[model samples]
Target chain A: MQLAHHSRAGGSVLVWTMLVMVILSLLAVEVLRAVSGRFQVGVQAATWQEALLGAESGVDLAVVELRKSLYPAPNGAWQDWTTVPGNGVLSHGLTTVPNAGLAGSPMNIEVNVDAPAQLKDPATGWQYYRIRTLGSLPLSGPPRVSYNKEDNRLRKLTLLNQRFIDGLFTSETNDAHAARRIEAIIRPLGSFDQAIMSVGVLDLNNQNIVIDSYDSRDPLKSTNALYPYNDRNADGTLKRQENGNIATNGSILDAGGAHVYGDVSTNSGTATGVANVTGEQRTDFYQDPIPIGAPTWTSINPAPSTVTNNTTLTASATKGAASSRYVLRAIDLSGPQTLTLAGNANGSQTYIEIYVTGDISLTGNAQLTVAPGVSATIYFKGDVDIAGNGLVNTNNQPGDLLFYGIQPDTGQNPYVKLGGNGAITAAVYAPGHDVTVNGGGSDGHVFGSAVGKTVTMTGVTNLHYDEALSSGGLINNYKIVSWFEDTR
Target chain B: MKLQLKKSGGFALSEVMVSTAVFSAVSMGLLMGFTSLERNFTATADFATNHADEMRISDYLALDLRRALSVQAAQNDTTILIPAYYDNAGNPQTPALDGRGGVVYGAIGSSVRVRYYLSGSTIYRQQDSAAPITVAMNVKDFVFNVTDLGKVVTTRITFNPTFMAGGASAAATAATAFYNTTLLRNSRTDIASSVY
Candidate 1:
């Protein structure tokens, strides 16, 4: 009986131990399968992320291509952007960097400018482009596909698996297994297109101030009573409506008599005893104060090799039409100063840009002249003072000569004081300080815009706004208005 | 009666039965654990796939709506009108003005006219009569609601998706909803229109 009982207990222990071992083994197998599945999925997720990065790389390349299109030669010669074939799509393939344990994928990009979706400026006829880009990475092929297709029956068995894999990566019908689309609206910065733009109080205290516009491109185009400022057609007929629009962030106080030929927009203040305003006197027009920041000064042609600091020129200084730029730290014209910019006789227009750091004082009949078809712009980083009959003389259109006051000198209370007895026909954009036009006896007839903080017209000054300047004759940088991703 | 019956040689009937019962109970517990793990895995995988699909569709809709000029939704489909212009190099062709001084914006460009709707279990996007692109599949339900707030337009999207896990026998589902408000960039209010 003892032998039988011992045998029974041993048999029971063996059966229980076998059962427990079998269960544990099966559980371990299941756990291994789950872990393997998770590893595979994780690898796929990493590939997806890498593909996205590749797509973004394509966008970066597109931005560079766009900049090239805007200024093709890089020497400031204008080129037609719309002339590029296939809407500016470049045939290029990008392979990502294989560094830091990452074997990047090969990406392809295609760019399309939605011409019909472009935005056009009504007054200037300048169009903004909407660029669409498609970035893609090819799909990975299944392993041992040839073996699976060796037999027709086996191929049939693998069809469903192949379909599943394709569905996982494919987007639309394109060859790109992983792909993304991006649409961006790029608009040029028309920051200085208006006739007058100011950031301070404006005062029109002159009685004989006449503000109007005329097209200087044509010598015969003039402002008259019946035509106002409209351009005449070839048959001497009015083409369309033209007006010289003026605006001020501050007040426009006409203390005495004044005649404004175009619309007068003031953010604040009242017009007192104004003789005539052709356009609407909009009091509700509000404009934010323009900030006076340092100039970007990007790739200005004929870049100065060295900066001119604290230089006073009393004799005549001549500059060639080709590659002429003056980057000065400080400049003063003492007496009888004449600066001349010669024309390029090869029918190529000459362009000149001047940058000043400190105060620019023009005293005792200082003059600046340029030939026809020559464009010149002076950028001042400090106060500008024209004390005695200083003039900027140019026979070209009013848009040819531009005075841009970008920054204010410290403690100088940077102001534009035009206290002379000569007419200056140029556009002045000073949004940091007040402008004082103190002259009389047919002296202060400004052909272009006079934008200042507080424009106190204490003399007989007339401001004329050229409608042609509002056209696409000015240069503006491209800006991205909106950017987003499309994952369709 | 000197016969000491050699103690019963094997286990008693009750002892055998009890051992068998305990073994059966432990096996059953292990089987239940495996089933629980599979169910949880299926649920997690389903949620991940659904979330990814929702994100893709959401991004596409937001970009389109923000650039659209006007949007109108109906029971069957939603139509979006996008104003388009062509740039002729630096010299853009002047837009024609009507008698009322309104700019006569002509036909929209290719791929600009978009319509989104649901057919069967798939969401289809039709662009200028192109082959309908399947934006999303296995969609159990979808809804689009548009609200116009003067200059701003808001669009609400809802998606309920169901996908097959393991095989046709095992089906998993996820539901999500979101609202995206877009301020129409180009309102089509130009100087000519306002003046007229």
Candidate 2:
């Protein structure tokens, strides 16, 4: 009986020991699982961040492509990128996982652009583009057709065909964990965004000045976009489109009862004597980046400028064809020397680009004439003084002639003065020069826009802003006008 | 007769001793296993909390730097000066002209100075002279480095482990160091700006 009892006690002990071991093992497994899960969470966060960075890089690459091939013939091409069919307005580019992201693995970046939008009413001109990009990490979702065939069921293309359908959402990022998409609109910061923009004070000393706007592309606004003020507003104003606005980073002084038919803005301080102006006078304006470098004509279709007497440059081919360029050290015409420019009215317009390294002084009957169908732009490095017969645009279109001033990295303050009667119809941009229109109090009737470091009109001037310039003219550089991450 | 019955019922001394020894060993083993389970659970929970803090710090700092016009930090300490942007209902308000027509800092509902500094183990984000808002807790180490003229910001943050056993290795007690380097998209110069 004693031997039997001893064996039975050991048997019960074994059962108790087994129960304790099973419970302990379960707890240990739970702890291990929790630790593993946390570790994975950390990894997931890092991968998502890398995906975001990659997407940003991808968008930048797309911008480079757009610049490389800026649509329309002679300026650039759309070579390596895929141009969407139906209207060559869209382009797409992709970077696969082989291209290392911020972290090295399973990440892909993609970018697409809906570029150079046109007006729906079919007037003319094109600008402004929308871009969408995707950044993906550990892209082991559904497979995509463009992805690697060997990794069939591992990665997916998040967006395609210009429709990230769930677009226009908050920045609440839809694709950060595995995929993300962002969208941005781009445009150029040209002089045409406003009528008159100056880095310093904008002094309008003339009371008879008619600062108004007209759209050259819109027929309903003018007689073939020539500006007789076809539209009238209830406020008894001409072409009350009110787009003949003016802005300055400094202050506006001595407006002197000017009939400004547009908005006035002085971002720095106050706007004095602007009581007769016919628009809102605001003081909250941001400065534009007009720091564009000089043109490198040596590298781009170089042609020496050797004309000293009366000269005429005919149209090369037509619009969109390669425009001829001439780089001259200086353009100094004194007493009877004339420079004539002619274009074709038969849809084959002439386009010319001129770079003047030194001063451009025209005095005593010295004339620079630009005929119809001629579009010319002058990027000058030194002072520009137009007296005597001055500069004349027979086309009477502001878009036909453009003057952009180039400031050196370090030099004395330069000047762009227009005291000649012929230097009336044009657009002028000199970010660092004092652009003074010494009209001598004559019929200060001027056309187009002016952007300078300081703009002063001493005479009775009527400056008209061509609204068409806002759509296409004098584009120095492109910028992201609006950007957002489509959280949707 | 009674004495004989009692003697028969009693067990041998060796038998009792062997049973005592086995039970004592089993109890000791069970106790040690439970202690280990509790320790692991607590350690893992603390580690996860630290990781959550890392993610939070990165998100806030990166967003602020990307939109800020400038950033400043004195050293690799738990302090950093952010860009000129004001907080409006959890949103960053951009720089704008005040009624005085100039960009002055700390104007009401306008651009304000945002600074992040440490207080003991707690991190606070101070906007102007306003009351500081707590951001993180139990941070053991922090580094805020600004380079490339406020265009590049690098940050490293570490949290202290809650429990450390005796004779534990240095690595076992050391928590993860979360590091990140971000660029100011608004001011970075490496991007392509002008074509020619």
Candidate 3:
């Protein structure tokens, strides 16, 4: 009985052991499957990320192309990018990552742009345009239709057309993860016609401030409406216009006795000094603010300057005298300084663009000059402090002497200050900050138009709006206003 | 002669009890191991899924915000409204502008009046009056902190993943946050003055 019992117990033990082994094996399999699934998910996540980055890169390339196509000529001729191929598509070569991750895959970029359409306001002649960009991963093999010999010719052709369009938006996988679509609306930054435009509050403290207009583009015009309000042009010529003055988005507080010779418009805030404004003073005229984009430093000749903090740039200094384009980090010119353009014999004007990365001080006699048909532009990334007889005199047209200021939100208020006895002849676009003309007891004047956060006149300063600036050829760059991604 | 042959058929009662007890203990241990492993595995999978969803949501918002002419966050930072246009093949669609220069989106575009919001635990995206799409799921919170820097706008998104797995509360769950500062690609004067 004992022997039989021992044998039976041994058999039962073996059976139980086998069952345990089987259970362990099944558990192991489940663990392996779970691990494999997790790895696959990780892989998919990485691919989706790559796809998104690829799409963004495609957009960046398109923007570069747009910049190249739209930059105006040296003679101030507009090269509208929207005119390219009318409703056609432009393709950038495929980009592939040649590493183990996402091996042998290429991302293609197709940019399609529609023709420009006129805005509702016909007088401005501003055209609005739209651009669409498709970023996709292309299929690795030829069409499946080609493998079937019995396919009809029409069917093959139809398949080819479908594949072609699909290639622009669809990826190799039917899954939408491999593709992205973005669309943008674009418009140009036209000329600034008003003598002064303030997006913020404007306080006029001077009584003798005279604002007027003249058409510099038309040489046959009657009398000069330039500075001194004396009916004499900057070149001693006679020209005049009854319209063109100040406009503001905020309130215009004219302390008693201030006078504006032309129209005054405030889109938002109240214009309190009714007695100060002469010609048609209209309130609540909604005006669109000018938009600005960061300037591309690519292809700019002469390396960026290494000048550091609080450095002075005199006419005699090495940095300021260079006739070539100079990118200054930060500069100060408190005394008399004249920037002259060289090599001007064949009417091939001197071309120079100065970019200031920090604060700029133009106190006392600060002047900028270019011979006939020559042009110069000053781009400021920070504040511009002009005070105490500081003058930016340019012989070229107001449009030729351009001042483009991009405000930096570094706690300091970015602005173009016109202190007492200071003056400038340039089209100013500091769309991000304020432009102040103050304390210029009798001689402060701004020849061109100002488009910025605010325009405040607290002195006997005058604004001379050049009617010729209304022409569309003055090239201000375009910026994206609205961007949307196609979720589908 | 009497002690010659006695046949015992099976195991003694105590021996049987010991074997059964041993088998039960081993089986329970195996089950426990598997259960622990599965819990960890499930947690990992849920985390990954949540991460991917966060990324997708962030990508969509970033892309749209980067090119947005105007971005307005409303309803206590729970909703965002954007007015934009995109070119569909050769057709150009844009949002209608209100008399106050605000975008009255939905004039004629995919989403002239696009809005993103959070309701309960799901993030939803809608265009005009169109039905909302689930932007992300398994979400505990969706919030936007928008800051306007003159020409450029920056937005921060906070996404939290809850610990609900298989209809049961998970012991561990972490929230994901994303910060993006998109310079307005399109220049729209109205964008600067828009109030959210």
Report the alpha-carbon TM-score of model 1 versus the true structure. 0.45
Model 1 lDDT per residue over A1-488, tens place: 88998999999999999998998798688666655554433333344445445545544554455445443144222133323423233233333344311244455454545433235555445555555555544444322222111121211122123222323222223342445555555554433445565565556665577666665544455543222345666788653333555666666645355676667676667756555767777665555533444545554433333232222221112332233556666556657765555556553556666777676777776655655556767778778887665655555356677777764655656787766665665667676667776654575566666667666667656666665554433343444444444432
Candidate 2: clashing pairs of residues: A69-A77, A175-A179, A175-A180, A391-A422, A391-A423, A444-A461
Supply every candidate's count of residue pairs whose N, Cα or C atoms clash at under 3 angstroms. 5, 6, 21
Model 3: lDDT of residue B137: 62
Least accurate 10 contiguous residues by lDDT in model 2 chain A: A146-155
Candidate order by decreasing TM-score? 2, 3, 1
- DockQ for all candidate structures vs. native: 0.09, 0.03, 0.14
Q: Candidate 3 residues B1-196, lDDT tens each?
A: 4344333446778999999999999999988987877777776656666565555566556655654555675531333445534344424354433322123234533235557777787767676687976776656545655676645666666544534444432223213555666655544445423211
Q: Write the per-residue lDDT of candidate 1 for residues B1-196, one digit (tens) a residue.
A: 3344445456788999999999889988978976877776665555544454454355445546655655665643776654343233322222332222123334322125678777887766676566877766665455555665534656665654433444332122223555666655443332221120
Q: List TM-score per model, in order.
A: 0.45, 0.49, 0.48
Give per-residue CA lDDT, model 3, range A39-101, as digits (tens): 544444455455556666655555455555544233222133323433333333344444423
Residue A274, candidate 2: C-alpha displacement in angstroms:
2.2
Q: Which ten residues in a row have the lowest lDDT in candidate 1 chain B?
A: B187-196
C-alpha local distance difference test of each model: 0.53, 0.62, 0.55
Ranking by lDDT: 2, 3, 1
Which candidate do you rate higher for DockQ, 1 or 3? 3
Off by over 4 Å in 1: A1-188, A191-473, A480-488, B1-13, B20-24, B59-111, B141-196
